[model samples]
Target chain A: MIREFSLNDLVFLLEALRWTVLLALVAAVGGGLLGLLVAILRTLAFRPANWLALSYINLVQGTPLLGQLFVFFFGLPLLGVNVDAWVAASISLSIYASAFLGEIWRGSLQSVSSRQWEAGASLGLTYMQRLTHVILPQAIRISIAPTVGFLVQLVKNTSLAALIGFVELTRASQIITAATFAPLTVYGIAAVLYFVVCFSLSQLSQRLERKYHAPR
Target chain B: MPLVDLADVHKSFGAVPVLKGISLTLEKGEIVAVIGRSGSGKSTMLRCINGLELVQSGRIVVDGIELTAPGADLNALRARAGMVFQSYNLFPHLSVERNVMLALKLVRKMSTEDARSLAHAMVAKVGLADKLSAFPDELSGGQQQRVAIARSLAMQPTLMLFDEITSALDPELVGEVLRVLESVAEEGMTMMLVTHEMNFARNVADRVIFMHEGRIHEDGPARETLSAPRTDELKSFLSAVLH
Candidate 1:
């Protein structure tokens, strides 16, 4: 039966949109923590740790996101760890985000002038003191724009979670369109919700860039 | 005991030797100027004393600490030996006050109030008391270099190394920075500087060590050496720099 795409359907989509937001938040926080570690390891002078970080970034980035989701979704069950789609989807997305964020932040850390380290050292600041007080503050300012830019990408990429039956915004839209046979209305609203989330992030990115980089 | 003692220090960048078996010493309160053509290792020698550059094989004892030892506490050594660079290197993100106060708070473990007062005093000494709140970019090149000096001075180091600190300044601005150095010298701070300023070297520095090809070619009283060069290298170097 082709029921109308009623208020009930709209509420369902909105609820699914909430899940989409939750997934992105989880991925960002998880990824951000892991990415910080990765960036530090990558930027350290120790070769073995640098190579380990680079290998992790390559492993995650080299594979397709969907492939990662599948590996976690199907592969986890094969190992007798019966995980749900949400588990699989969030884990895969976080790993995916970490690789890119790690690379972005590593570049930011390196972009700080090498002389800054020397200046800090000559002042008797310990290595950790230099990293935290002198280096990270400047690196964070440089990383702000690109880091938010990547968050937008992460939000949009959450749509791919629907294929694993995670029932996020896109998955809910699919169910609604199947019943109402209104692909245009269902997909259009989904697109707008994604736009709303992404546009706000980009706006925040610009505002932060201006605040941190303003000449004193 | 000498304030600084460098005995047979050797340093090379990869394959190219920069300092070749150099030995020198500085007494307390001595103002020594290192003058040489570029790549003659004047700057490298100053840096080696601060433990910024590790010598291949030598003994570097500064203010009673042996820097060439296998496990020397460089941070402890550096705190006692302040260095100002050619580029000023005033932390761009910090206000002048903060730049001067950073090491005081972190290394000296001073209370914030004490650091702030000392920062003010150091900035005044460098003649930038009015620009204490200004950022590095807002200040003129001379002002920024003065702030850099204040930043180092706030540490109350036993020795100060100035590596071509005025070489990057405009010719008119050079005198202001040099004047600040003169004041610092009057306070009886032990200073070692690499400079292209012949007049400043002659007037202010008590001793001039002229380097030629990674070796100290002449080390003598500044006025006598400047008036009568002992080596062809020193005479030619003076002509090239002054003319």
Candidate 2:
């Protein structure tokens, strides 16, 4: 007798896909805010603050996301910091995303011309005033396209959470495939779901790039 | 009291001196033109007066506020002095009106409605009334410079500094900007200009100073300096530029 794939199994995978999206949202929002702070600290003139921020960025980016998830999931228990799979996955993804996002934003902020700062100073604006009034507005325009593009990568990376026993889309597919003995069919559906979400985000980012190129 | 006074100003960048032992004084409602070769520190002198470039050793007083002192209020000093740059550094993201109104609203604390009306008037003065909504990139070089002038005028400063404002424009486009400046001079607005346009400098400036090797070489009436320069350097510079 041949083993069969059922609609009930596909439905469970679809349900888990929702959690994947929710986790991506939590990671993106949480990571984006923390990353902005890190970017600012890295650019500030204070010596110790700048070095501390750089060390944080280097540590997070040097380690692999899978390894980070492992630490957060398995190592936390030894320290008596017990947390559920969902909480562990979200926190791990947020840390992973913050490093990349912080670097990207720093590049954007530095891209503004030195002349803009000179102009602001000539007008006697303080450092913070110049940043808010003159520099950030221009830097934000240059940053939008790249920032949205990074969101797509963040969404796809959510699959790594499955390694830590999170029942997101990939984990759900693995469970179904073990029972049905149909790895190809079950994993194919999961790939399709991920592609749909990631592809839409990619298209949106491209459209924004084009719009930014068009004359105001 | 003189509106601006500089005593033995000295500035350098990384050991290469830009302005060395410069001193000058300007009374209210005076127009002085600063002339120099490309690297003679004419632009740096103008920048120092406005607090854009800090001097290493000097006493710079504008409207009785010592610019070189540690406790001086730079914003208040800048409020009374305005500068126009060669590149016409209007904010690209803001419209012409907002570009002019920014200092009015932010620095002067003018109400939005009042600042808007003042900005429109300044734009009209520069012959850009119809282009109030236009972005900086949409305008030509001359138009952009005029808008920059309007932006400065909106601040209602007591002294204006023009740093090679027309050097970046096309030859044909220079006249319109000069004409606006001529009318401004007629209104007795105190201005210190760094310019290469000898004719405009001769026609409009109350006094002209020739700078060389990071110091002033000659200072005299505009006609006397342009027609009968005292030194061979000024003579050769005029001959090469005019011919």
The number of the candidate with the highest lDDT is 1
Candidate 1 local lDDT, A1-216, one digit each (tens): 998889999999999999999999999999999998998899788999999999999999999999999999999999999999999998999999999999999998898898899999999999988888888888888899889999999999999999999999999999999999999999999999999999999999989888887332
Find the 10 residues in a row with the least total lDDT in model 1 chain B. B87-96
TM-score of each: 0.97, 0.94
lDDT of 2 by residue, A1-216 (tens): 435799999889999999999999999998998899899899989999899989999999998888988898998999999988899899988888888888889998898888777666666567777789888888877877778778888888898888888989998988888889999999999999999998988787777767654222
Model 1, B1-243: lDDT tens digits are 999998999999999999999999999999999999999999999989988899898899999999999899999999999999999888877889999888899999999999999999999988889998888889999999999999999999999999999999998999899999999999999999999998999999999999988899999999999989988989998888778
Please write out the lDDT profile of model 2 over residues B1-243, one tens digit for every residue.
999999999999989999889999999999999998999999999999988888999899998999999978888888789889999988887899988887788788899999999999999999999999998899999999999898888888899999999999999999999999998899999999999999999999989999999999999999988999999999999998899
Each model's lDDT comes to: 0.93, 0.89
Over 4 Å off in model 1, which ranges? A214-216
Docking quality class, candidate 2: medium
- Taken in order, the candidates have interface RMSDs of 1.4, 1.9
